[model samples]
Target: MLQDNFGRRFYYLRLSITDVCNFRCNYCLPDGYECDHDRDFLSLAEIKRLAAGFASMGTEKIRITGGEPALRKDLPDIIQACKQTNGIKTVAITSNGFKLAEHLPTWVDSGLDALNVSIDSFDPRQFQAITGKDKLDEILSGIDNGLSSGFTNIKINTVLMREYNAHDINSFFNYVKDKPVSLRFIELMQTGDNKDFYQQQHVSGQHIKNQLLANGWLPTIRHKAAGPAEVYAHPDYQGTIGLIMPYAKDFCDTCNRLRVSSLGKLHLCLFADEGLSLKEQLQIDDPLPLQRRIMSLLNDKQATHFLNEGFTGATKHLSMLGG
Candidate 1:
């Protein structure tokens, strides 16, 4: 198993298949995707090898992330590739849910175990304002389609921004009181280029957490391979709420995930300044060198991201890290 010197176990891998997203979210890519250099993302063969490498090291969960993962036409094939890996148990994807209702059937056939869709606001105009897209209705319909298609664990990700939708929590609560989906409220984080914007709009996840606790939402025991969200359940509600609060104290203590860029760089943490290029090792078509390299280098992984200290690291935007 891949265990850091700090004794934090690694069981999940968030792999960014591409950095191309169509949405122009205010916090992420407000101007839409701009190719800085040749985005020679990993090929299918390389992805297969990478999945195998992680599986060999006891990684059980692989989350496919991207600027918007569904943009790739061959996404079903990619999901199938990770699912076919011997030791990989759960294959999930995070997307903007661009055409999820249309594509979810094929994705389910390819063994996708879970889905997380980004929906920043419940109000259509506010959603359009935040995402630069007028597809909130379509995305919500896609989520409904997921429910009808047997997706019992569909998660809707909402970035909590003071200026955007933080105060409008009632809309989310009412929506979730009936649906069995999970609503995740993520705190607006400071990326390398978003310092000014972060200062202007950042909302602590604690704000929402406090409200939930007061409303009688009880924390749920997390599964061993779950991601970094602190989940909660309410007796009267069908859905659950999750809070991804990076700035919360002891947030990094349960670090169980590692990130890989679309170009094959291993980012030890989302806010890590440096990443080790595993591209050369990925080309060998063997899991040993890749596994060994990841296992060895993880000893240097930081015990904390130091997000509270205002360090945003090399990540210029959420899209760069597939957030």
Candidate 2:
């Protein structure tokens, strides 16, 4: 197992297949996605090697993320490669759900275990305003299609912001009350280019927690390989609620996940200042050299990120690093 200096053993990997997204979400890309320069993302063979190396080190859950992973026509192949890799127990994807309904079958056939669709607002008008996309209905429809097609339990990701969806928390609760979905309210995080926006729109996940508790939402136990979300359930509701409070006390205390940029660099934390390139070792099929480099990189993994101190590190865009 990959144990950092802080004694946190790693078990999850967030691997980015590409850095291109088609959304302009207010908190993330209000200006929409821009191409700073030409780039070459990882190939299928390279991704296979990377997953193998991590699995050899005891990583079990691999989440495929991107600016929008669906944009890649070969995403199913990517998912299949990771699923077929030894020691990988779960292969999931986080997408904008742009055209997920049209593409769900291929992914399921390739061994997709879970799906997370980003839907910030339940109202179509508000969703378009927040994400600059008029596809809320389509995305939700895609989710329904997946469920009807026998997909695993669905999870909807909503980024909580004072200006965007804070007032609509109850609306979210209503949406999930009748459905068997897990709705996660992620606290707005500060990034390199989003400092001013974060200041303007950040909402506390704790406040949401207070509301949930008052309403009788009971905290549930998290899976061993779960992401950093405090999940809750209620006897009166069919769905569950989760809060991802990054700025909360000891938020990173149970860090067991790591990220790999699309360009094949290892990120100890999403907000770390720089990434150590593993591209060189990725070219070879040997896991020894790759594992050694990863072991060396973990030595630099600190106890937690410096987000509270206003340091966004090398993360200007979560899409780029698959946060």
Candidate 3:
């Protein structure tokens, strides 16, 4: 396993299968954004080889992401290939869940370990306003289908902005309380298309916690030993609720993963401008240098993202970062 300066073990690698998406979510990928790198996107075979390379270097968990991973045609093939890799223990995916109703079961058969579905609001109109799409019913139905298909450890990711969805936090928790899925409330970060929306939407983990307390929640961590999300199980609630505060409180200190863009560039930090490209070397008739380059860049993982640096404007959308 790869260990950083602070001894945080690196094992997870988020692989973006494609940068193309279906929705124009305001905070994620907006409609007017002109930069598209579909031509530079990695082929299925290349992605498989990259996964094998990462697995060879002691990475065990690989989460297949995309602008909307479901938008990719042959996603199951990639999942199967990653799962077959000896060192990789988990193969997962993160999607908006718009197309999940159709392809989720196929993904399970393809060996997906878990899933994180992005659902901003339960209100149909509000969801449309947030996602720039009117598929709230489809998204919810997709979650139900996944659950019915025996996906027990599912998680719903909801970004709680100050005015946008803060009022709906308790509603979201209440709705998912009876389900066998974990609900994650992510604090809005100022990045990508969210840069403009950041000032108006910035809400802290403290704000979410305070709301839970007001709702008569004596919440405690669902697992004494959990990952970055400060997960809590309500006293009489069925499922757990989690808080991800990347902006208010950085978890970069214990960050143990890196992102490989669909175009084969490795980003050490989410906000970093530089990326190590492996596409060229992977195409050539050489493997040793490519592997060395990967490990060398991994060793140089940033201690923390400069979210506090007052970085403004949506320079790179979340899709560009393999969200």
Candidate 4:
């Protein structure tokens, strides 16, 4: 196992296939954002080799992320490659659900084990305002399609902001109360592009928890998961609720994952800007050298990030870092 100095065994990998996205969410990406076509993204073969390497080192879970992973024509191929890797027990995707309906069947056939879709609000106007897209109905239909297509572990991710979609909390819970999907409310993080907005609208996860408690939602003890979300359930509801408060809560003590950008830079922490270039190391004909280098870098992983200290080291956009 890839154990860091702090004894955190790294087994989860959040791999970003591409930085290109279909929507310009107010907090994640800037408006009129254009992906640089000239930048080199990791090819399928490189991604497979790296994934296999990580699996060999005791990594069991891998979540494919992106500005929007479904935008890639070869996404199904990528999913299948990760799923087929030895020692990889789970393969999932975090998507915007823009073109999810069209690609859901292919993804399911490719051995997708779980899914998390980004849906900020139930109201059309608020949804459009949050995501800068007018396809609220399309996203809703995609959710239904995902359910009908047999995705059992589907989750809906909602980022809570004080001035934004925070008021939609009750409506969001009401909409998913009878559904088999879990609704996760994420606390806004201070990213390079959204720092100002985050400062202005950040909402504490404790407030959301209090609201749920007031609404008669009881906390439930659940099995430990790789992700950072604190989960809850109510007997009257068909699905559960989760809270991811990176800012309000210190989940770093339990951090057990690493992230690799689409361009092949390995990030030790989501808020950390410094990363090792695994793509450059992959050029060598021998795989052992690259694997050894990865292990060495893993040992140097920082115990925690400085987000709480208001540290912003790199100017790269959040999409480039991969969520």
Candidate 5:
């Protein structure tokens, strides 16, 4: 297995198929926010080539991400291409769930192992306010479609903000309590040029934990999967609620993930701005040299991020890098 300097085994790769998104979420991609690397976007063929080469080096789990991966025209084709690679055990996608229902069967047939949908609030108005759109009904319908899509696993990602959706925590839990889905609460991270927005609405993992305690939730240890969230299953409820406390509790000490942007730049940390390029190498007929370069980068991976006090750092957008 290819391991990083932290001794963390590098097995999971979150690949962004596209940087463009349909909706303008407030926390992640705010209004009038244009992505920096739009001009350098990679083609479908190049994405497949890099994925195939990465699998050969030891990547076992792959998740297709985007500003909205569903916005990509040939998403199913891209999913199929990723699965066609060797050494990849699990293949999933993170989507805004906009047009998921229309492509349900095709998504299933494309070898999709799991799906994580971004749903912030249960209230329609709040949803609109948060996502900067009024398509809550479409998203809800997509969830129903996703459940009926026969996916092996389904996860709901909710970014917890201080006064915005924090009070609705109980309601959010009540909404999905008996359902067969895992609800994940993500702490907002300060990334990109939106430092002011993040600071204004930042909520830590402890804040979420305290809220759960207020509602009589007893803390319990959870299984650490490849995903960043630290999950906790409700004892009485059928479904689980996870807390991705990236700002509160650091998971970088055991970080084992590597990400590739839609433009073919490899990101070592989720919060890191600069990334290593693989576009040129992927264009070559042989990908062995490209694979060796990836291996070398993995060997030089840092143990932790520099988030709180410059001690640990993760650089990349949560949306672009796959939450």
Candidate 6:
């Protein structure tokens, strides 16, 4: 098992397969930004090798993230490879749900364990304004298709921003009242390409909770999950509501995960500029070296992130860091 100096056991890994996204979310990516086609992403063979190494070192969950993971033509193959890796218990993906509808059946067959879709707003204009795309209908269709495809653990990720989609909390809850999926509201973080926008529009999770409470929603104690979201459910509602408050509340003490970019850099913290490069190490035939490198990096994991201290780090965009 990989245990940091702080005694936190690391079992989860968020692997960014690619940084290429189709939509330009206002906060995540700048408008008119194009992904560099020349960038070298990790090959399927390399990802499989890394997954096996991580699994051998006590990592149980692997969540595939990207600018948009579905954009990768071989995503199903990637998921299947990770799922088949020994010691890896669950394989999942976090996406913008742009192409989920078209790929749901194939992914389900690929041993996908869970799905988290980013849906900022339901209103057409607000959705376009936030994501710089007019595909709200397509995204909604994709989510419905996911539900119909029997994905029980599907989650809707919404970033709460003041004067933006914060007022749509009740609407979001109402929209998914009968669905089995969980709605998770995430507090806007200081990272990403548009830090200025985040600073201007960031909303507190407490404010969202207050809005839900005012609307007769009751909170419930829920079991802790691999992610940071705090879950809550209404007495009469069918779906549960969750809040991920990275800024409003400190979750670093209980953090137990690591991230690896597409280029094979082991990120100890989401907001940290430093990381251990695994690109060259992965090329070696021996797996022991990669395993030791992972252990060494975990030992050096930051006890707490400095996002609260106004340290956004060098890798600011979510596209580069993965969602």
| Tens-digit lDDT string for candidate 5 (1-323) | 66776677778888987777777788777763466654566777887788788788678888989878887778888888888887788888888888767775688799888888889888899888888888878877877876765563888888888767977788878866777788888887777555777778887767667767776665556322377666666678767778887655547866767889877888887766467888779897587888788887766566566677532134434566664
Which residue ranges in model 3 land beyond 4 Å of their true spot? 210-227, 284-287, 312-315
**Candidate 6 global lDDT:** 0.83
Residue 221, model 3: Cα distance from true site in angstroms: 7.5
7-38: candidate 2 lDDT, tens digit per residue: 99999999998889999988788898897856
Candidate 2 TM-score over all chains jointly: 0.98
True-vs-predicted CA distance for residue 318, candidate 1, Å: 0.9
> Taking the tens digit of each residue's C-alpha lDDT, what string does model 6 give over 174-222?
8778988889998888874676898899888887778778878776664
Clashing pairs in 4: none
Q: How much lDDT does each candidate structure score? A: 0.91, 0.90, 0.77, 0.82, 0.75, 0.83
User: Could you tell me the TM-score of candidate 5?
Assistant: 0.90
Name the TM-score of candidate 6: 0.94
Count clashing residue pairs in model 3.
0
Stretches of candidate 6 off by over 4 Å are: 35-38, 211-225
lDDT of 4 by residue, 52-122 (tens): 88888888999999878887889999999999998999999998888667878789999999999888888
Q: Using Cα atoms with residue i matched to residue i, what is each candidate's TM-score against the true structure? A: 0.98, 0.98, 0.90, 0.94, 0.90, 0.94
Summarize candidate 1's per-residue lDDT along 33-61 as a digit string, tens digits: 99996989988989999999999988999
Better of 2 and 3 by TM-score: 2
Model with the higher TM-score, candidate 1 or 6: 1
Q: Which sequence of candidate numbers ranks them by lDDT, best first?
A: 1, 2, 6, 4, 3, 5
